[model samples]
Target: MRRRKLSPEERDLWSRVAATTQAIHPVRPAPPDDLPAPQSTPKQKPPPPKPDLRDFRIGQSAPGFVLRQDLAPPLSERLAAGPVRMDRKAHQKMTRGRLEPEGRIDLHGMTLAQAHPELIRFILNAQSAGKRLVLVITGKGKRGLDEGPIPQRQGALRHQVPHWLHLPPLAAAVLQVTPAHQKHGGSGAYYVYMRRNR
Candidate 1:
């Protein structure tokens, strides 16, 4: 259907009527009393104050202490009378050949490439020779490949010895392991105790 456009006078009159309606109906706000009151939150309790003490003594000596006298040999004498039993198996393993001068072998300056095959042969030969204790110096891999490309993640043999000991030929011969003495190579070496091949 065709619609006819409003003339200029009619358009002007419609716009004035719309403006009058908007001015009269400007949004009426809610009364102030209808809005929420400010909340009154309770105050939190403060932490308790630190205690004050005039006299507090730790490790205080007791007055008039009577000592019980020993009727047997002194503690040191008693301990020395019997062989000292090591509580740790590892300590015992490390000292298995403490009295034997020829029981240990140091492999400190050798690399994994050199030591791996030699270690297998060494264990078999030592076992065959009836040697129970052997010292291996894998050195603490702390100084591993510092200046080379593809730097070693482990301290050379420091970390590799234990894993190598667990391999087929070596694992079959080894009975126990423990950290070596400072004179023997300290943390860089280990005392590998082997079981006698029957």
Candidate 2:
């Protein structure tokens, strides 16, 4: 391919750039090659001097990296503003139990220690089985508690189950964790979104 020569305007612009680059930083003399080597008890080199603010003139080429804004696409073309790619409406549908769950696990009557491992197993299996939305029944906690210094939380599993879903072992397989619809288990249950096994 034949290379195109710069227009007169471009030549003038580059000439100005070259002139300013040289003017801002006068050339420094190099140390002589025959200079004696430093002693074993080496003196610490002084820190580099601060930049001369005047040398930071606009349009001066920087030492390392520069983002080429001129080459970038227009804002409208780059952004393509619209609804986010994530289908939030569909996610809402799943959370509302409008979509049928692929699997269900009832964790009622189980202690927290027992329920934690069971929850992990259920999610892992569901993901491997290619299940997306699964219902976990945690049972709505008791309302009234005996008055004490520290009142116990109502629902153990309901609160703790969500935390377990975010843990490393289960976080990979799970996506969104939302309360189940009235039909599934309502506040007592949750709809666990699982990632597809690849």
Candidate 3:
């Protein structure tokens, strides 16, 4: 306990009382070369390179994969954008196959629980047998084994038989579903048109 060395007039009176007090730990002044040097919030663009899947395997085939857009819009362009409901000159001769399906119903190999009760018993017996233009084939769909990650729109009865001919037990015996002309089965058949059994 022997410390005592300050005599130069007490080291100029302790450097004038430590430059008039104040420095609980302050030595940080070195940033004046014309300001502006603290901007670090622009590094968030490194998240778009995750499609390598380590030499990817599951059913390969993505070499130049280019789909550019299609999360739905080809069930024959959603049944040719609906809204024709029937009889515009017999729906233009049943979509140009020149009207002639007085009842067809193939539904391919069934299985949406046997094609929704055989398409609600063939559109309620083709509108109680008064048919007007049946057809309803549903084929174009076999590309299977996609292995998930969403992308399966091939033909579960060509998109659920035009959504079970518009639900409610065949939307009251249909009356106009369209999409069938390429000689009656283009986007895989579907010219329902029935309602008329009063």
Candidate 4:
């Protein structure tokens, strides 16, 4: 088939149309300068401070603490005298029987090596006896006392008691264990709560 070619005038007309289209569609300029810039609002103030915990006092109603003594038979049977020497005011505060728990136990005279087995037995026996809590006292070891001039190889019973509490037999019987309060035996004692025996 034969084709027809555009004359010069026709070509010139097409070019003019393309140029006119581009000019009409010139890129829109950024929004007019009359619009204001965005300003952020100020931050709100924080709420007032909470009460200081240091100012709070432990109430007489705080749970009673016990000292576990390791003394043998007759000596072990008696409850250890309260280690804390309370002032007259403090003593009066305890007159209401507010600081006593259900029971107490003492482990003071026994070494860890000896006491470990007794501790296991006590937990089991305490559970069977329907006792919920017991106290175990492990004295702050022979720190200043005479021993080899250099620190001896002897272990600290105070530190060893906690380790025994974490052992399998004792841990299984114990539901929870915590350090005794000051009026009890303080850091030298622990309060052991036993799981109910099935």
Candidate 5:
């Protein structure tokens, strides 16, 4: 059926009537005060005043809240800055010679020139292969039997290895450099703990 267009006055009146029309609440008989609540699902308790601790998801029946990772401190600041000491358990185990190294590199005969580069390469390779604990054997130098014209120092690599590990290139990968446990070579070697590769 064709509809007729309304005059301006009729349109204004109709708009006013529509604007005045309020949504009406549906009416239903209330349940008796003693009637049990619906059993299809349990009522949810209101969430605690504070948000839950972790970001874990809850069961389908319940809702979960995501903790704000964006509001957290930046990674550089959050991390313990320079070098992370081995966690207590690992430190204890390592100090006691219980935790064995995943890999080891011996600089028994390499010169200072050779040892530095080799040390860097060894650490990088270990980190790439996902080895966290490793041994770096820098053998203790032999003592001179006779007093030479020039006095020589013993354990050059032993002293230098610690310094090299602290340098920038290897420093980022190396977590800690410590004296090797007795079973690993004692004073002649070092235990290098590497950070997880990102």
Candidate 6:
């Protein structure tokens, strides 16, 4: 194959530019054959020091393993930890089952769609009728077949009711909502204290 020859001006420009540049990777010298060949095996870090197992028994936990704890507190603890929005003394009595609920609504066996509007209507009517406290019974949810990747929490309604009570429509009429006392249904129901209708 014939090579294209550079013009005189082009050849001059190439020589000038090439003179200013340094080789990024200069050619390396060949190693002597008499010396041992360089090992191809890459240097590896020492395996993480084996955990001390001298005293470990067959069933004992491995050293440095921590007993896992739940990241979030239980639902009851979270509710009790919230700041008091109602009168302190009355709040105390209400939680202790001393204040009786004037009206009760059992919302068990209903889907979320079926239960929400009913709850709103019940709370609104109770407030207008001069009720002070009411019971919202969202039975402790059943353990259904958990077929999804994420683990499901028991009591869908139980967890959702409190969140619903805090939203605008119900939040206006509701003064406080707490898990019910044992006689009133324990964690299965809630004591919903109503604000004055006016």
TM-score winner among the candidates? 6
Best by lDDT: 6
Provide the clashing-pair count of each candidate structure: 1, 0, 0, 11, 0, 1
Cα misplacement distance, residue 157 of candidate 5 (Å): 0.7
TM-scores of all models? 0.48, 0.54, 0.26, 0.43, 0.54, 0.65
Per-residue CA lDDT of candidate 1, range 3-70, in tens? 99999999999999987764656686755997886689999999999889556478875344333433
Candidate 2: Cα lDDT at 71 = 50
lDDT of each: 0.65, 0.75, 0.79, 0.61, 0.79, 0.89
Residue ranges of candidate 6 with Cα displaced over 4 Å: 1-70
Better of 2 and 3 by TM-score: 2
Candidate 1, superposed: residue stretches over 4 Å from native: 1-101, 144-154
Descending-lDDT candidate ranking: 6, 5, 3, 2, 1, 4
| Cα-based lDDT at residue 120, candidate 4 | 76
Q: Model 5 clash pairs?
A: none
Model 6 scores a C-alpha lDDT of 0.89
Pick by lDDT: 1 or 2, better one: 2
Backbone clash total for model 3 is 0
* Clashing pairs for predicted structure model 6, backbone only: 141-155
Per-residue CA lDDT of model 3 for 11-63, tens digit only, reads 99889988999989989888899997787897777777766556778998766
Least accurate 10 contiguous residues by lDDT in model 4: 73-82
Put down candidate 5 lDDT per residue, 25-143, tens digits, no spaces: 85777788899766687789997699667565656343443232235443223332445477978876886789889999999888899999898888999999999999999988775
- lDDT score of model 1? 0.65
Residue-level lDDT of model 2, residues 78-157, one tens digit each, is: 32232323358877687556899988999988999999889888899999999888899989877554345454566777
lDDT per residue, candidate 6, 153-198, as tens digits?
Answer: 7888998999999998998998888899999999999999999988
**Candidate 2 global lDDT:** 0.75
Q: Least accurate stretch of 10 residues (summed lDDT) in model 2?
A: 75-84
